[model samples]
Target: MQSKVTTTKEKYPDKPITFIVPFGAGGAMDLVARILEKSAVKHLGQPLVIINKPGSAGTLGWNELVTSAPDGYTIGISASELFLHPLYGTSRYNYPTALEPLAQISSTPVIMVVKADQPWQNATDLIAYAKEHPGELKFGHSGVGSIPHVVGETFSKSANITLSQVPFRSAAEAVTALLGEHIQIVFINPGTVKEYVKSGMLKTLAVADANHLVDPVFANALTFKEQGLELFYGNQFGVVAPKEMPADIRARLITGLDAMINDPDFKKDIEAMGLQYEYLDTKQMQTQWIFENKKLTNAVQESGVVELIKSQKQ
Candidate 1:
């Protein structure tokens, strides 16, 4: 049996692997997939063919991914949406259970930002104005089941403010709307708005992280906790396969992914795109998944994000 297993592993992945990206092309997720694809050829001895199946706040693609055969030929990228979609009835499977986590590639801390012309200078000013005006202020997010949406809602709840929540197909879209003055604020990844923030087109208010970002552009930014809200959220990107994938196959994929992420060129590419490189092995990724799952469960429930999603549909 052991020899057979070894032979099977050695001969596995004779064909190209389909990498399902649940978000649109030109987005952060797509970029990550492309970067991994470059490294896969070296480590896995097989090409990773990226397929974009973006829609329905990422559920459309993730649904297809979770239902794919567990033969190791089809794998997908996992983000906060993997765990979040289930909470709001947008997904068919619970994350970290329905899928096997291979490795964590990167983490992008969620940040609050406003148009440069907005009246609020910092989180304090924004929260104070929000308290005064209630739902009069509007904030845009990627989608109902995205990290930005959940973090935005949680921030609202923690600050006891009723800002009007706006949903866009992608974080880029939300940021665009913010620039057009269609919304007053946005909860997004700092890297996405780094250029705008530097050019004085957008202003970052607070980051939903324990420590301020080390990026010199945002090093001085304060955390939501420092602004008197206990909100801390981030966007974690990783690789996953169907839960029932054979242990041998899973091990092979993990080995490939671990090697791919550790590549110096891969790290450089991810950092160049403004994403923080924080690689976690399978075991560490699983532990982090559990912690994030519990925390997200509470954030979703306490922040009334489900109710918010339901109301949006209605």
Candidate 2:
């Protein structure tokens, strides 16, 4: 049943609100959720309950949130790319109409990386090499439906190479695999690989953006597009609720989210991740979600990963 209290001020006046984080503790999504939890609770005069549901590249827990009641009692922090998972390949569930977009919390690049001493000097060199040896190149990602996983798929379809995809549990795990030479390449958040690039532990091949990430790593690293590739852009994350929620309730949630988006603390935190405060309202989110779903479907059809994504459903 819908909560009798429709406003954030009204509904959350007496009790805590639960925010489901689709990744494990201490990861990027988790970190953002924790901070926002503090700010949101203070703003709303209620506690924000953060529950971590980590598995299946974040799909496992996200599915849980989507299936929850449409009342404003439950909310979720999830990545934008997850909407692409089922279309990209296969999964047990879909991002249901029960969920609505509260806001896009922040955006980050899915960057391509390699061992510091790899033979390739730039993305072009890597592409040339991969073209010559398709499927021989190995790349790592957090999991089959992760941003990194889709990023790899996007790059391969654009470049027409058969780079093998390896899925790990976290960005740290994928980076460690790269360091240990267990994998030759992987797409990761800049923060996850920044220390390694500084210490000569890894090399940044290209960022999914048209330009390079200049903060933790300088912009000269090179872009995949500059290498004559056809793809650009990567994943971002957001806050969402059930789709059929009342207008007033949606406004209340967005109000809370907008306050946090404009707050100094949230800005600083996102900047530290090499991310910008690019928030999307429900309409923008829906439109983009549809567009991305199409791209993912095409990619999956081309890459032959539909069955793989299907088997990963938890």
Highest TM-score: give the candidate number.
Answer: 1
Candidate 1 C-alpha error for residue 152, in Å: 1.1
Q: Each candidate: RMSD to true structure?
A: 2.7, 3.5
Please give the CA lDDT of all the candidate structures.
Answer: 0.85, 0.72
Error of 2 at 53 (Å): 1.4
What pairs collide in candidate 1?
none
**CA displacement after TM-score superposition, residue 100 of candidate 1 (Å):** 0.6
Tens digits of per-residue lDDT for model 1, 1-314: 99986786678888999999987776678878999998787999899999988777788778888899998999999887777777877566776588888899999899999988888888999989988887889999877778888888888877888888888777778888999999999998776787888888988899998988877788888888888888888989999888788778888888888999999999988887767899999899999999888888888887788888767766
For each candidate, give its TM-score against the true structure. 0.90, 0.83
Per-candidate clashes come to 0, 4
| Poorest lDDT segment (10 consecutive residues) of candidate 2 | 1-10
Model 2 TM-score on a 0 to 1 scale = 0.83
In model 2, what lDDT does residue 267 have?
Answer: 79
TM-score, prediction 1 = 0.90
